[model samples]
Target: MSMNTLPRIEGPHADGADPAGWCDATRAYLPQSTWTGLFPGGSATSAAKALLDMQMLLPGEEGRFTRRFSRAVPGRPRLYGINVDRVMVYKAG
Candidate 1:
């Protein structure tokens, strides 16, 4: 993607206070994880990296936010309800 086409947006925790907005891009991204299921797992460092890379916004139910993007894994999408994990969401927008 071009420099202007990059989706440089992120959403902070609902209870978070500091404006975790991206202050830099070129050196910001998602954290690295190691492979446990399908792919290797990675660290939750992206949230921090994104803090300085992408513009931080408040978390929302839907829409393009950091949760929608960062929470995305190899196959799984979101985990709703109790501790039950989920692969795809059926909620309507």
Candidate 2:
């Protein structure tokens, strides 16, 4: 696919944000035939639900996931923030 036709994915950030909305936005950029393949056995909403459920079982961690686009001019790269999941920990001495 050409750079102009590349697909973009994003996640919810605000309180009460709908997860399905994020999936819908991503699905909009993809071809209809690829939707099923991209989100096998389920729609975007179902996929998001499954992911959230799985994340719940994992240990708390913090980090930033970054993405960069191919530069045409060969200079400083641009970084895109994908998602940030922060877990707070309080330790008492």
Candidate 3:
């Protein structure tokens, strides 16, 4: 599966955020299966550029990308959402 970032609600850490929570949440929901090693896709910047290329930003316009936690833990701030850009390939046999 190919991974990509999904639109998220703006939060405090709008610039950058850890993806551990998102990964954990996804793994939890996904069915258990035998998996193979992960392969590199490309840099986030390249992905971002591809997104931007789809549209024309105003001169000097800047775009922002953020990845936040997928869920909240007790006493911890809700700082994450969903990220769709994380692609995973596995074999089931």
Candidate 4:
């Protein structure tokens, strides 16, 4: 619940990619435990930040939206974009 720490994202996380391609890609990786926490409601700033983080949208001329999440290191906080539900929505262009 901070002013501008990190924004929760919105939208679909995956699109125009091989959906099942990532399945066997991690075949040789070790498995670890992960926990999830969901904050359904948040502040305006928080929501804005979340929208930015999720959208990862760049400032444009007008009201054009463009961006997409990444597959590589999707959870890295340094990168900003929308978290399309459970998936990351990175900027496309």
Candidate 5:
């Protein structure tokens, strides 16, 4: 979906808040495929860019990751410093 059609993000605070929390809050509004597409390159920079471009993340949010955020691969599940499967993974600190 285009940025114009995406959900309206309120407040910079919410946009730059916890990634997982934002994902959970937006789950009802966004499709899982949207999140999946955000990390096409499995790099934290790219993923953050996608989110920034989409207005899901604000500028400088990309630097929050201690490691690159990886996408899910065969026989491997995504990690976001939490116990969840098929989610993005990165060390946000």
Candidate 6:
């Protein structure tokens, strides 16, 4: 995807603020172990990396202001609650 398509929106802070939103958004879909692995510290940096590594992120950057564009992991099986296929994850850190 082109850089222009990636939204420049900032995400929740890298610190442990508003963690419930992040967890609620991601954890239910991922296996417990996988969820733990991706967000051991519950930080936005980890969220960015996980989304990028999964090939869900486009690309852009700056200081603590990195940008990531992500969509749901398309073919991943739903391990828990509802499928998040329509979810689009955006993280900036």
Candidate with best TM-score: 6
lDDT per residue for candidate 2 within 1-93, as digits (tens), equals 322343334332444422221212212222223434556765744644453454411221243212232332123133222122311111121
**TM-score, one value per model:** 0.16, 0.21, 0.23, 0.17, 0.23, 0.24
Clashes of 5: 1
lDDT of each: 0.27, 0.30, 0.28, 0.28, 0.34, 0.35
- Which TM-score value belongs to model 1? 0.16
Candidate 1's error at 22, in angstroms? 16
4-63 per-residue lDDT for model 5 (tens digits): 443333423332333322122322122234445545556655765555454445333245
Q: What is the C-alpha RMSD of each candidate to the true structure, in Å?
A: 17.1, 16.0, 12.2, 14.8, 14.3, 14.9
> What's the distance in Å from true for residue 3, model 6?
19
The residue-by-residue lDDT of candidate 4 on 1-93, one tens digit each, is 121322223323354422211212111111111001122334433543455555432322233222233445344222222233323223232
Q: After TM-score superposition, what is the CA distance of residue 9 in candidate 6 from its true location, in Å?
A: 12
lDDT score for residue 69 of model 6: 22
- Model 1: how far residue 68 lies from native, Å: 6.1
The TM-score of candidate 4 is 0.17
Off by over 4 Å in 2: 1-28, 48-93
Judge candidate 5 at residue 56 and give its lDDT. 44
The window of 10 residues in a row where model 6 has the poorest summed lDDT is: 74-83
lDDT by residue (1-93, candidate 1, tens digit) is: 132432333433334322212212332222112112212345233443342233332332454223432442232232111110111121221
Checking candidate 2 for backbone clashes, the offending pairs are none
The lowest-lDDT stretch of 10 consecutive residues in candidate 3 is 28-37
RMSD of 6: 14.9
